[model samples]
Target: MNPLPTACKDEVVLTLPTILLPGLGIPASAWNNVKAHVPNAYATDRLDSHSPLSLEGQVNRVIEFMDDRDIDQAQLVAHSMASFIGEAACRLHPERFTRLILVDGSYEERRKACLRIPIEKLIPHATLRAIVQEWRCYSFWANELREIQRSHPLRTRTVVIAAYACRPGRWVRKLRRQAQQLSALFVPMKGSHRLMLDRPEAIAALIREDPPQAQRHDGYAL
Candidate 1:
């Protein structure tokens, strides 16, 4: 099926821009090589972890970013925490998205679903920042997790790509099966979770596999 378009009419973000997000301790530059392969992709920075958000806040941030770029509908590609961010966004607004290309998305799913500790309230703001500077992780913010869990599937075309060599053979198989159960097109690639840094062309090629219709294409008016 053809991919959807962004809400904007002018300043088209064509070539099926692959909106990319990085996991913890990673930076937007991780997708630089990947973006070099995929001309229209957009990857955000994770280095400035000075500010972080809850799941809802993260999703809203993505929506707002898309709004700024006039990207109404685009494929979501992310790793680790950022992968969850895109997933939460798709779950919240399924109609606004198309395909999801998740990398290491199901990383420690069972382990990461713990209760959120009110670290901010327990400790001083400066102390909290020093202790855990990064924003909301999977385990915290139980309410948002509940909402995502309770959410009905929007029937989005999902794809889950895993690291080919990260886990044991049995565990990897289990993860692949889990991806399938989640209704995602499972693909185990040859690398670690941070494969984007080493193999951008490979990642870009995968994204290009299902190109979305661009807003600036001829005869396809907004």
Candidate 2:
């Protein structure tokens, strides 16, 4: 018997994750917690190493996935590094997305810090699962925790804005240095490392606040 197709393109509520992180340390089945609430949510599987590590690759994969499933656009809710990819997609192909809801994290900070860290000297296996364990274990007591807290979406947008603005060109430079990058600035929220897992309800509520395509049919976009 032919196996069932993995990607689902139906026009239901959609939410995607950051590609860098591996499943947020949560079980795939745990995603049902959010999916149960949304109408039809599809989660993209982890990317193969052969795929480009640049943010554009992530965006292309999503676009391709949707295309394969006959989906034109979707409502994206990205977590962590995935937020960067979502932002890139929005800027490059705004029409392809209806609404965007970035979870409690950002890639602008992560990519820079990770690049500086001597990963090969630190840990050869730089997989998402390994990173999660490293975080939980307090492996790098450098400045990850502080940065993570600062990137919380719960933190007043004003505060986050000020934090980034005060940093001068360092943050922006890191983002700009990346050639094929997502061009959206992510909003930080209040929560620990696991933003979505720690605050799914809050995220879901925020998503619900976004007016769907059906509601915008009145010729007055929200």
Candidate 3:
């Protein structure tokens, strides 16, 4: 682990170790820019492509990574589909997470469905094959989402950063509604879904900012 710079008394404080999880089919390199600005943070490799297909398996991978590094607790930053994995991990082990930061994430429940064609067999490229395998795990994703919905109002502090640029109004509204449902702090960001890639500095700032005291919103616990 890297050491923090020396500081005068009351000048500097430690921040929670941060774990960055990328979206489905997106490489961990997508978080390189954001990682550059964060200290004591680690970005997970592309688990959506090569890791286990089941959500429980993916969550286990994260736990194992933390355990290997002796990280007892961390702040999770998840983007897109990885939000499902992060939420599930936190739900299963809430004591291990200090905060959950979800970027451009959706909590809409999904139902399992079979793909008519076997794209993996048809596609020769390795990258395409990986994507096909990820798609094949739709049932896992659906089951995880269902479990998260059933276990709402996560014990860990939660924040939802919704991207508004170039996105449909309804989609943005849906994200806002989901944030409300989770009783999470809602932050509206000006960018596309790939905020970590396009606005890494801003995202890092949000990560480093002190979490606000929990408050009630529309009678919902936050």
lDDT of 3 by residue, 46-89 (tens): 54336677777888999998999888888999998888888888
The lDDT of model 1 is: 0.66
Across 135-186, the per-residue lDDT of candidate 2 in tens digits comes to: 3322222233333334432211110110122233554344333311323332
Single out the weakest 10-residue window by summed lDDT for candidate 1: 213-222
Model 3 global lDDT (CA atoms, 0 to 1): 0.76
Candidate 1 local lDDT, 1-222, one digit each (tens)? 223443345744346657898876676787888887676678876454344557777778888878888887788897876766777777888877778887766445444545446565555655344235444455653346556857656467877766666433765576578577677766666676687875566577667662432221122221
- Model 1 residue 187 lDDT score: 64
Give all TM-scores, in the order shown.
0.74, 0.50, 0.83
Best by TM-score: 3
Checking candidate 3 for backbone clashes, the offending pairs are: none
Instruction: State candidate 1's TM-score.
Output: 0.74
TM-score of 2: 0.50
Q: Name the better of 2 and 3 by lDDT.
A: 3
Better of 1 and 2 by TM-score: 1
Worst 10 residues of 3 by lDDT: 210-219
- Sorting all predicted structures by TM-score, with the top scorer first, yields 3, 1, 2
Query: Which regions in candidate 1 have their CA more than 4 angstroms from the true location?
Result: 1-14, 111-136, 141-143, 166-170, 210-222
